[model samples]
Target: MFAGHDPYLVALSVIVAILGGYTGFGLAARIRGTPGLARRLLLAGAAGFLAVGIWTMHFVGMLAAPIPPAAAYLVLPTIISFLICALVVGISLFFVSIGDPSRQRVIASALLLGAGIVSMHYVGVHAVSGPFHIVHRPGMILLSSLIAVLSAYGGLRIYLARQGGLRLVLSAVAFGIAVSGMHYTAMHGMTFSTMPLDMVPMSDGLVASAQVLSLVVALLCFVIAAGFLLFLVPEPRPRPLAGFPGGFYPASEAPGPVSEGLQTASRSDRSVMTTAPLGGIGQPRQLPVQRIPVEAADGTRLVDVTEIRAIRADAHYTMVHDGQRERMCSWSISEAETKLDPAVFIRVHRSHIVSLPHVAFLRKEGDGAIVELDGPQPTIVPVSRAKIAEIRARLGLTKTVPPRH
Candidate 1:
């Protein structure tokens, strides 16, 4: 029979689980912000810790109970439990990697992670010593699974939403409770026992809580060390790839040998030393916005950057607004913003970036401001309430608008 009641261990496990889950989420969130090899190593180490922590926490809960003749786990299945936790951590972090994950994708990833957690719990359950048939109450099992999924979803949501301070801690606590609750609930739902006379005594191979702790600590240390080594390894600097034209180029116009300074600029960017009368073999590279080259719908024609006015996020790529024409470029708004000169182009909204020089007038309508540009064809851009001050400063509007109620 399994260990009966162990509230103290369960409570302790819950606390540990929450802290581990939260720590993983926090570290995973920081992964992208960290540059180069450090980010990759840190992400792996963080994922490993979260996984191992959850696995060990379950065993800790197991240790809380005292079964007849003492309870021990089979070695192989116990090891597998740790792997399941790591899988869950890896999957959760992967979902967070997407800049803007869809709701369905996020929920699905969380549900899958929870399922792995559930699997880990059962695997540990099976690791119990002795040949015993285990039966689970269907209703209880489903309820526990639901709890795991919901808990995982909540934690993922908080991490993706970038919740801070009290909220984040609360989310961690909630996740921990879910982990503990699932373990105890599953433990109670199952009935496992062997015939007294036929039951085999536990052997040296059986896992103890101490063994689990040592294993987890060792794996955590390994992960951290691997990450540190990765951090030490310098990442290769990105070299400028072939210039983008999406077509055959004349021999004279073919890409020249790339220089060190030009390596940072995208190959797709159309850069010239200068378009001025003095433009020749060696002049400073053109401004970022001026360097952008656009391929026409026919692909045979290329448009200069001066023709472009504004850019907006459209599906996966950005829509280049050039007078009456619109061209789709395979670049995200954020990516495009980095290449453009900040003084000329400003990201006015999440999806919208506009050329400041194109602005003819700013009209105030209630709480919102609309920018109408002066050109052969006028384009109206809506400014969000959050960007009001930024718009004012950029547009050089000395008058301060009253705050909205």
Candidate 2:
């Protein structure tokens, strides 16, 4: 039944839907892990739920506005508008969902979705009917998107800090409540309406409260879903025969805890590079250590080893040098790695390992090519060659690619 709709009322409906959409996406992402049929089904369900929930919420909120006799004109456009809002919000949430199973991702996802919903609603409101008129200013849209992204990032950081303990759940609750409250508070601000609160028993508060509760409860369900999904979809198992170093034979007889620890430390570095000292002029440098074997995820074999003369840790990753050879790696040294095995590293590239001290020059050609050292001489690291840019970045090289023709 169509009824009277006010600008503020429309805004309220959109905000509620945004909250619902964010909650739904986060829940779906957490519950669905695999990338096949099951995940698709779960995602479809989430999208449907978001579409219906937002549409219904807004439809009800627009009760104050006069309805046109052209119901058909309204229905289709309304569905499309609500869907666009939900999809934008859901996509933001999707980005946040790919990170580690931390509370931060959930919160970030929620905030991003919320902000998307809000921005889209405001923009839509400006276009359709509201106290604010559409400006069609690209700057405003960019600014709004930027703000939303920042808020999402902040939410993610907060969530991450509060994950893994009873405090995590508490933080989630607090975050959800805070967001829901903020949504209502902002919605309430849309109008130049200085009108006093229209008291109709607890009905208004009840609806608002229910929506908030739903958002908070949905977040908790997402947490559970994420946990279970993580459990179900195990990490990628390293191939046993990918690369085995001479000493790294039997899984049991692999390096002891110390070596294991070192490998772990290397893996965690994430931006390590190994380079060999350049000859006379400013050239590549080698790492201090030499002959470190790259370990597979499975402790069974060693993918490869590099010779480095020096090591440099990048802002985000690690680098190691072995003579003229250079290798870039993501694995970094952490306290945990100090207690692991020596053969626990991964060979992301021919010239790179978990260690940053064994990388040579990373060269970009057609696909990608890395130049590393076998002994003291530079050996062409066999890689796809497409990964060269990635290698350079990992090595902290600042050279940019020439423009394509």
Candidate 3:
């Protein structure tokens, strides 16, 4: 016969699952902004959190079920199950984050993740050692597997979309449902049969008591709570005085004489400035930026202004497309515009800027226009209604019309 589950414990398990999902997904979202070792570490941490969440939820659900009094958990199998979850989760994340994740890659990753969840669930279930045998209905196992796959795909899509606020919360909730639903559904189809009195349980293998398991679960819960809190802490904004015209400098290294001009320059003029020695007396001259700072896997590198085809805004930072591939830039869109020569580069849209010299094609699209920049991998930048006329004039496309007939 099926075992009854504690409703309160079930609810608690769901909560733990949701919290873990939220924290793990939040960490993964930051992987895009980070580079190299930092990105790998973050990915690992995210996987660990997610694995812990799934493992914890499964055990909590198991605790809720009324198993035979003689049943105990095998330490080795329980530990192996958790390791399996972590390994698969890490592999899945790595697959998606490595390069441009295609549709096939995403699907493959999702399949792997879903299979990992199912494997962890069953492995954990089989860890129970006692004078009883467990059997699961084939149909229910298939249904649970389907739910796992679908839920995993949905979660990955949401993460890729990168929408924050309400969407992230909803995704976490859905993930919680997916994990808990699969566990309970499988449990529903499970039947336990008592073993014969002569049957002997293994005595050599180490086992964990319910009390010890409770302590472990409590410790994991605390770790998840701590991670959740740390994730909520907002990143400190860089101080205004910590930047220079051509690049960023420490506040302590900032020149004193130019500080006034730096503070007084308008957004557009901030990047166009000249400075003299600390005590020298001379009129300031123009010193436009020649190179743009961008981040790469190896390290921070500078891209020549002439090499930039387009710059797209990414929150507080910008993405620099250097005719080949896009690289993350530490500068804001406003900063990029101010620093680059206005004669060649133009801010065509709120979030986009294009190099006029690289303009290969321009076409009117509805109320605005689109300009294709010539490069190995051509980029299309949108032209806002306000900037359409200016973009046309800069590209020598503006034409005079004859008098009306």
List, in order, the clash count of every candidate structure.
0, 90, 0
Model 1 bad stretches (over 4 Å): 1-4, 131-133, 163-167, 199-405
- Which parts of model 2 have CA positions greater than 4 angstroms off? 1-26, 29-32, 46-77, 99-115, 123-151, 154-189, 192-405
Candidate 1 residue-wise lDDT, 1-405, digit = tens = 234657676666766676676666656755644546866876786787578667867877766654444445678888888888897779777766544355787888888888999999989877777545567899989988998898788877766544234555776677777788877877777776656655665455646654565466456545544543453465353333233233322111223333222323332342232121132344454446555544342342445656667776643456666766445566666567666766577666556778888888887766767787666767777765455566677778877789999
Model 2, 206-321: lDDT tens digits are 12222343364355334434543453464353233322333232231123453333333332242221221213124543323323442222332222344333333322233444
Estimate every model's Cα lDDT from 0 to 1. Answer: 0.64, 0.40, 0.78
Candidate 2 local lDDT, residue 168 = 37
Q: With candidate 1 superimposed using the best TM-score fit, by how many Å does residue 173's alpha carbon deviate from the native?
A: 2.5
| Model 3 lDDT at residue 387 | 68
Task: Give per-residue lDDT, candidate 2, residue 101.
Answer: 33
Highest lDDT scorer? 3
**CA lDDT of 105 in candidate 3?**
85
Output the lDDT of residue 384, model 1.
51
Predict model 2's lDDT versus the native. Answer: 0.40
- Lowest-sum lDDT 10-residue window in model 1: 270-279
Candidate 3 weakest lDDT stretch, 10 residues: 270-279
